[model samples]
Target: MSRHFYSCPLRWSDMDAFGHVNNAVFISYLEEARIDFMFRLAPGDGSPSFSGGSVVARHEIDYKRPLVHRHEPVTIESWVTKINAASLTIAYEIKDEGQVYVRASTVVVPYDLAAGRPRRITEEERMYLLKYLDDDATGTNKSAEDAEDKDALAA
Candidate 1:
């Protein structure tokens, strides 16, 4: 499966007193990439796309290195890791110039706004997500899945 890539610009305000991007801001970059991948491609307007709605069920992140403010945009590579009946996981890497700053994944549950509840993945949405599924993720997807399962058990 091919990964979707988004070029994310870093804002000066994203930096902290330590001269690096704030830890919390990295999640925003992940979000930008995810929306480009999962929502923007297909229109929602009563279509079988995520723009209709989805919610983040959980997040897992590992900060690998620090990133400072820069003119060049960082590349965020995103792809689907897992697909459950009512949810799907998307993994990401915020990196540039051979250096990785953050690795993360978000579990997203498709939402039925009219029904006011989570909904199952439709055949169309599933097919769309399957295009981004990476079955050879070097064990990272397993770790993400394990973390989600552990969190579920706890909840």
Candidate 2:
């Protein structure tokens, strides 16, 4: 199993009155990461690939810590958690200096633009997704304690 990592820059505009990143901005971070992964997996060359695009069926997010604006980029790690006939779940973690700030998942259904309906994932798409399959039984790549320890060491 592998993880797709995207380095997202934190903007001053992302912060709210409380001085932490606004909750709504977290979704945009996840979206940017997902888009990067999808583009890497399937370049939009008009081929019958997952790059055709997908619709978000569901989103689940757990904010572990409030992220303050920083010059350093935050890292978003994404991987496939499950793949069904027409949908797949993508798990993500937003981390800075190895400390996780948010954990999330998004269920997306492959969509057909021409037909205006959801469609099954092709074999090629399935195999590509399997490359990033989350094999950990706990469903998380790293424990909170582990992340904290790594962050401490990095500092």
If scored against the real structure, what TM-score would every candidate get?
0.85, 0.87
Query: For this target, which candidate reaches the highest TM-score against the unseen true structure?
Result: 2
Stretches of model 2 off by over 4 angstroms after superposition: 44-46, 141-155
Among the numbered candidates, top lDDT falls to: 2
Model 2 CA lDDT for position 42: 73
Clashing pairs for predicted structure model 2, backbone only: none
Clashing pairs in 1: none
Task: Give one digit per residue, the lDDT tens place, for model 2 in 1-155.
Answer: 88999999999999999999999999999999998987775766655687666899999998878899989999999999998999999999899775688889999999998899999999988898989998862458467556765675687
